[model samples]
Target: MTTDENLGKAAIFDLDGTLLDSMGVWDQIDAAFLAKRGITVPDDYMETVTAMQFREIARYTIDRFDLDDTEDGLMAEWDRMAHDAYTSIVQPKAHALDYLRYLKATGARLAVATTMPAGLRAPALGHAGMLDLFDAIVGVDDVGRGKEHPDIYLEAAARVGVPAHAATVFEDLLAGVQSAAGAGMHVWGVYDESSAQSWPAIQSIAQGVLDDFAQAPRPLA
Candidate 1:
């Protein structure tokens, strides 16, 4: 499919695992955080928190590890650990910036539907040279829930001046794909090692599947 087939549509992207190759930041944080308590990061930890909001992740962490930390305390610690990486180390996924530009040039409205806050997400996308291209950026905080709900995707499309059905969401997690598709939008699953285990499940439900942004729609012109 090409942009010619979906002109003027909004392209909503999930930041951490979809448009940006930044899931490693969380993995590093998880290992370091758990190691401080003399525990090793479990294999299922990342998968469990991949679709959760920061508060949810923190709460889950405290309960799972029997840690004596409140959600706020854990979240603050994570923010401190992640600030430097998001500001400097995180980068756009392969061909992602080019694909965003391609969509823009073809008159597709762009938006980010992410769990990352403005401070972190903005700099990361700016560093990747595509921050200014997005017409809107919405987060789970903006919707009061995680990607398990379609609220964020709906808000992003509305902010970009498109109806849900006219928007296409690019996501790396099955939860995100399911939520956006359930909202009556087109959902394309983007490849990310963090969600590799769900790739088959994602492929089954998503309207499309992409190895990278290169496989996404483009302008024939």
Candidate 2:
């Protein structure tokens, strides 16, 4: 058992760039999807769409490309490609699995609140051998509202049977941090070299920031 497991507190993780390095998977998926439709978007399209729900991205793609297909069709194609890329190339973020294991061993209740669909979240976590680490795995559809809204975080906290205020959220995006903060959870900002330079808002909201899971210095409150 690890110290974290004994905390009697819940910690929620955001999956994409936060718990796993799957943002690039989404980028590749989006590129492929747009390419198939003979459409192209800005170079930083992925950055622009970070933390967006599928429905939201679909609307963006439709508006940007003026596609022939219905929104459902476009979403299907994108989701299929994303699932493929996630299975083949996406990887857990550095130290993410180990940190989850430590949290489990130490008796903390761990959960995932992500924009990813439940179908994808399961296999990805299973592949990383971290699926069982979570007491709850909530996806975008499980909540009343999406990212940038507190509903998902609130739902995750509820899933763990904890009040939102007692949970700690680990996230990489500003919007997600804001959502969790609004849900009244303590927040931890996880950073990469790329995001580190532009995380002022997250820095302001986070109780603390860490480069990776190995650097999670504080015990759960």
The whole-model lDDT of each prediction reads 0.86, 0.78
Show model 2 residue runs off by greater than 4 Å: 2-5, 193-197
Say which candidate scores most in lDDT. Answer: 1
> Each prediction's TM-score against the native?
0.93, 0.90
90-199 in candidate 1: lDDT tens per residue?
88888999888888777788999998865677778878898899999898988889999999999999998999988889999999999998999988999999999999
lDDT (tens digit, per residue) of candidate 2 on 70-146: 87888777667777667767788888888887777777788898988666888888776788889998877776456
In model 2, residue pairs whose N, Cα or C atoms come closer than 3 Å (at least 3 residues apart or on different chains), thus clashing, are: 2-105, 2-106, 5-106, 5-107, 5-108, 6-106
